[model samples]
Target: MRPRKPALRPGKPMVRRGVPVGSPFRLLLLGASFALTGYAGVRLLADDWFAVAVWFVGAALLHDLVLLPLYAVADRSVVRGLDATGHRDRALYVRVPAALSGLLLLVWFPLISGRVERRYRLGTGLSPDGFLARWLLITAVLFGAAALLLALRLRRATKQRPPATH
Candidate 1:
């Protein structure tokens, strides 16, 4: 005897073999992403495949062995400090800016620190001098915006709350 298919509710997602498959639009998006990744992989491999493979392996090892633990510890410390200060709910304000800053630093490290000045200038014919300043400015802006948002949220909450009783 064949197994009966499960009946899906009007608003519920479709499930196949006990796994939620999500909407057809999501499946189409996933397929398109996979195809794009495969195309990029083919083009990359057509170049220096060995160097790319080695770099990928090295990046994976470095992230797993070093970066992962470092960030985990840093995040835990932040959470602990916020929790102790009774402002744990406001951790996102600190985390978002720090994460954006860290990402910018990571992506532009060589240029920002002037390590690749000669190579970058040779390739692009432009000096890689102002990246550090620009990155710092962007980091400042992200933090300032996050702080402003937090201040507004606090003000709104205060206004919404009733007056304290004696």
Candidate 2:
């Protein structure tokens, strides 16, 4: 005699046992992306792509081993500084703009500093002369905008609050 299987209710969607909460469509998409990445990686191996592959692996390892610790320490320092000051308000305003600007600088350092001017110009047919100035201006704008928004939000919040009684 066979054991009886549990029946699923009609209204609830069928969920696989041992799986965490997530949409079936999202799981399907994740599987497809992994498959496509594996396919591309295999194709790259066939084209004598060892150097590029090794460089990518090395870069990943370097970022994990070095950059991750450095950034973590910096962030911890900032948090500690805020804690020491006893004024933690608007930390997100500073952190968000600084993080975005740092990421932009990291991504565009070579172009911004003209270190790879010839290579960049050859590849894209565009000059890299203005990159440094543009990046600085963008950094300033990001911080300025963040500061303005924080000020506005604080002002509105203050207006909405009732006055403290003596």
Candidate 3:
């Protein structure tokens, strides 16, 4: 079903008719989410909160100060390299898989690095020895799929072009 356009006030900007600009429902949902987060934080703080607070602050600072610059530099390098090769369109294919793999590595660093091997085994009754291999396999699959998709897009683009006149 199509949305109905609502009449706008003389000075007001245009918006979809059925949806109000600055939706009250979105505001309500945002307020609800904040309230729930605050409630959870309070409950969590009731027991040994200092460490949790420290962790939260430290993670934010580390990501901002360290990881962000590191990744930004890496992305710039990728872009520069692709541009030099005259294949900038292929950058997204590389970037998407790399970003996904990086995220997976970041989230599972402890298991992947075997730093928490004992704790992991105690918690899950399984070895973390295979994490590296699994991560590698996942990274390989992501890149392979991305390459396939890039090839398909290139093929489609070529096919959509009209023939050149002699």
lDDT of 2 at 70: 84
For model 3, which pairs clash? 5-17, 6-17
- Per-candidate local distance difference test: 0.88, 0.82, 0.87
Location of the lowest summed lDDT over 10 successive residues in candidate 3: 6-15
Per-model RMSD to reference: 8.2, 8.8, 8.6
| Candidate 1 structure, TM-score to reference | 0.65
Q: Give the candidate number with the greatest TM-score.
A: 1
Q: For residues 14-44, what per-residue lDDT tens digits would candidate 2 score against the true structure?
A: 4567754456666678889999989988887
TM-score for each model = 0.65, 0.60, 0.61
Over the stretch 1-166, how does candidate 1's per-residue lDDT look in tens digits?
6658655544346665687777777778889999998999889878899999889898999999998898888888898999999999988998899988998898879889999899999999997888999999999999999999999999889888888821
**Displacement of the residue 41 alpha carbon in candidate 1, Å:** 14
Summed over model 1, clashes come to: 0
> Which ranking of candidates, highest TM-score first?
1, 3, 2
